[model samples]
Target: MPKKLYNIDFYKFIESLDLHSFTVTDVTRYLFETYSKEFDNKKNATQFVYRHLKRLSKEGIISAIQGKSGKAIVFRWCTESSEDSELVHRTEIYGNKTNDLIVSQLQEKIRRYKTEMLMSVGETEAYSEWVQEMPDFAEYVKPHYQNTREQAKLMLGKVKGFERLLAEHEARLS
Candidate 1:
């Protein structure tokens, strides 16, 4: 039998953080220290904390501000007693429809690039066959065939990147 996965109400967890503003790293460390026994390791606990924070921010349950260096993200807890209702309103607007639009665009790009890569593969195969049948034209066909393969590789790379982006967006939606 498989172990069942349990869902944690992260909003409640965040609420228990006691209305204190904290950086993502600080939150991760705090969770890891509090629930060290529940997780296999600190890294796993940290990742879990990050996942919840992202979901909460995306759903407008919390507000995140980019740090001065632009790499560190500080998350502010939202509560009924919060002083800045306007800031909360702005945060609510953050993940509304723009994420969906970006996800849709990324999916479309992934689909188109995948199809192009397949076509490029077919063209490369045809070129190889032509070169085999006509040795004299091999010089002319070889460079084009290589170029097509390179193009296919680039397209595949793009598809992977777009797929990753789509997954991130979907995670936020979830």
Candidate 2:
């Protein structure tokens, strides 16, 4: 069974850090390889950063300041708190309404998906094409058919009498 990833208290940890603020990319790489060593799915550094910023902003533990370059949100930790303070209550700077928009979009997608799954396909569409039409599935499988000649040859070699196999397969289909 695959392990479930619980949402982390990313903001609290951000608060714990001594720096005024840091880049999300830098933080995620640190979190993935360093703190969250057990979790290896760190490829979405931007998502991780966005989610953490949203979480932290909701709690008021951190604030997103205009980046040094301008127009970018560089997250900076709060400094007004007393040095001895431990219990911090961070409220969502951006409200559930923002999150609601995302949820509603996802819900709309799920509704569309359920509706789509229940519907029949066009006469010209193959089942593989149907699956590949999905954004996630399409992106996931786009590279699947991208084998180089050498790799294709290697894969072909792995088959037991692939030529004969194809002939038999065609015969069976016929």
Best by TM-score: 1
Residue 156 miss distance in model 2 (angstroms): 82
- Residue-level error in angstroms, candidate 2, position 129: 69
Q: List ranges where model 1 is wrong by over 4 Å.
A: 1-94
Q: TM-score of every model?
A: 0.45, 0.39
Error of 2 at 171 (Å): 84
- lDDT by residue (1-174, candidate 2, tens digit) is 554454666645555565677777667766676556556577654566677677766566667777878756777766644434325332232444555565565455545544443332221144347455765675554454332333444433433244444446446545
1-174: candidate 1 lDDT, tens digit per residue: 553232555555666777567776787676777666777777676677777789768766677889889899888865633436635665657656677678778988999999999999999999999999998999999899999999999999999988988888788789
Per-model tally of clashing residue pairs: 0, 5
True-vs-predicted CA distance for residue 108, candidate 1, Å: 1.1
Clashes of 2: 5
